[model samples]
Target: MICGVKQPILLVLVHSAPENFEKRKAIRETWGQDQEGVKLLFMLGIANESEVEKTLEEENVQYKDFVQGNFIDTYHNLTYKHVMVLKYAVYHCPEAKFLLKVDDDVFVNMPNLKIFMKLFMAQNSERKKILCSRMCGNPVLREGRWGVEISEYPESMYPNHCSGFAILYPHDTIFALYSEAQKTKYFWIDDVHVSGTLAKKLCVTHIGLEELILSDDEVVEIVDSSFINNTKPFLFGRMNLDVHQIRILWDFVSKYTPKKVILDYLNY
Candidate 1:
């Protein structure tokens, strides 16, 4: 269990590269602070360089919120990273009500997330679902950056899966998927393999991104409007933002009052 947190309502585990000290620092200083009902942890793989490992150890000594796996830190080993998270959660923080998986670069609106969870619990107390940006029929590229061999994924289109950048899962759902993942064949594409294929195999309920909140366009408009009058966004993704940008956005969103107008647009 992370320090200062007993039984967390939500545990956010961020997948980070071992050398991304700056990104981790930015997150802790910005949105990853230790809240009453929330706990924050960063997942990392072994670093090849001695200096990087030394630095990571030092950071862990100070923060004590890092979960490290044995595999080498590489894009292709993300599946291993995901599995490590599930195992860690099941063993270490089983009492947490929800688990949020996110990448290091994504910006999380923590206040909005807490509000969303409160609304969600009011409706469905069971909390047996996965919530994320849904992706359907994504093509399997044979070459380039996201290349995959035919043997890896023979199907032309991927199964319905949530984007791995940011995903929220109930604790029960996480346990179910984690058990299923052990039986499924390992695939290097973390999002497709874990959230898409394995989730399909287990028949986990996936709540689409649109249902949780309005589209990103409306969110941006709201954020760009009168800062004092704007409503908070549930989350913002695919943002390659720097520390300065994160701090600015965090401060801006923290002050915004959530309005019922935005809630009216939500599908569920």
Candidate 2:
């Protein structure tokens, strides 16, 4: 479906935990459909427990859209999953125009994502760029939950980077980042490490997508407004939505936007 009619606009690599089987199925049924220029691939790592592995195998049998890595699936190992995306994208789906790395909890509007890409590509030349809420000058913690040992990163502050919750990576950066991640010392914070440290090492530019992405509060606000106004918000994405919330949001948004996506598809 990628290199066919639409030139493969987006490949979404979703970060998912090993045991979240139902959530994956729900997503596949909802917004994760592989249609148009969008293809969905789930990024998973090895589960610690055999039960979890069994569950994952069962789930994989159902949808079979996984690009799993050998690293253990844990919070501290998110960078492993992050690098897995770069490796897979580099060697496997290199022809895809863009890679959308998103958390499983986030809600993405397919039509709005299409529109966002059209707008992003129109205003900017097709180069190694990221589109997301960019982070800059983040302090390196030493004693907190997300603390990094002096050995991990001796720097006082982090470099400019795109937020990992929902990042859009131009195709050119995939091999560069994969190569960088292999040489760079591993950092547990995937966003700062892969998106910031490795990204800066290769001179990747980022375009701010803050306006298109919604916050947790904004998610509630948008859902409420959609209920009140009988129409959905025209934003690119939402964060921390559960399966039920996503289902409801899709029910409302799908009703309102089928004609719009059809129109946009024709226009593109």
> By TM-score, who's the top model here?
1
lDDT of each: 0.79, 0.76
Total colliding residue pairs, candidate 1? 0
Tell me which residue pairs clash in candidate 1: none
What is the lDDT for 132 in model 1? Answer: 83
The stretch of ten residues in a row with the least summed lDDT in candidate 2 is: 259-268
Compose the digit string of candidate 1's lDDT tens values, residues 221-262: 544553355443455534555676567667877777566533
Q: Considering every candidate listed, which one attains the maximal lDDT?
A: 1
Judged by whole-model lDDT over C-alpha atoms, candidate 2 comes out at 0.76
Predicted candidate 2, C-alpha RMSD? 4.3
TM-score of each: 0.89, 0.87
True lDDT of residue 43, candidate 1: 99
